[model samples]
Target: MPDRVRPMRTVPRLGTYNGFGRTLLGRTKPDADGACFATHWFTLLLLPIRPLGRYYVKEGATVERSTGPGASTSTTEYVFLGEAELRASEVIRTYLFRWVVVPLVVAGPVTVFGLNSDAYSREHPLLFLLLLLGIPIGGIIVLAVALGLREKFLSSARVPEWVGSGPPRG
Candidate 1:
């Protein structure tokens, strides 16, 4: 039998995140072989030791369209591992709280104490540099802890029903 040419469908745009990012949802119609595919795209933040950047992660799923003629369709669901479904705002808040606020909370007191002691400041000039470096280190630690908690929460929780709903089509 000749291969069937499936028409390409337009994916739905779920949410707008500042002009820098967007979320895409899509599902391909079943082919001659009775196989269907679903896909999703979302922006992700990549924090490095120095410069930070953002990128998109594409996730997808595939399954047999149906067991037999007029039979119920079965799908193989895909879930993001070690990550929770978070809104753009939550993601931003998470990074800020973990990478900025937590570090400042720790660094503020140490900075104050160091500046108050003349002897310490004079004898330990390197401490200032160390404090500067500690901010990033503290932020890294906070990121790790936050990710761990998110993983735990996601693992124990159920995937939202909306996530399984293939992208809206016009």
Candidate 2:
């Protein structure tokens, strides 16, 4: 009988995104040269509708100078190598990542109000009640801010449809 050999298996890379709207999800782990495949998605709100092709991307850094006096910051940035097919699991990850963030989001206010309110509620009942109204106001402002930041980040993403493309990359 002829000898039989087993085929080698490759593991699909798994990645979670921190921001939404649309995304270029990493398709494979970065190789030794720091290049990988990433697929950009077309989305409606949080739901991913279609992949825009897989593009090659390289991991790199983006530096931004502050408008103020001599301040600058560097953030990890991806150089698009050019490719989009979004899997259901990747869409699900969008939801999962937000769920994971919920507790920490809720915790901040709860902790702040819980720790500070006892005396305030008892001594200044009306003011304490009024302070509760600020929660929704703060939430609206936060939502606006989050959307704005998503725009800034996506500007460099070459996101095809959902949002507009930023800059051309390799």
Instruction: Please report the candidate that would top lDDT against the real structure.
Output: 2
List candidate 1 stretches off by more than 4 Å. 1-119, 153-155, 162-170
- The digit string of per-residue lDDT tens for model 1 on 10-67 reads 3334333342333323222333333333323444342212212111222447465666
What is the total number of backbone clashes in candidate 2? 8
lDDT tens per residue, model 2, 1-170: 11111121232232233434455643444545665556566555434455554555676775666756875543456655433334455456544544444434544675688687998899988877666666645755775686567545642333232113532433
Report how far off residue 68 is in candidate 1 (Å): 55
Per TM-score, the best of the predicted structures is: 2
lDDT for 148 in candidate 1 is: 73
RMSD of 2: 13.8
lDDT of 2 at 85: 38
TM-score of each: 0.34, 0.37
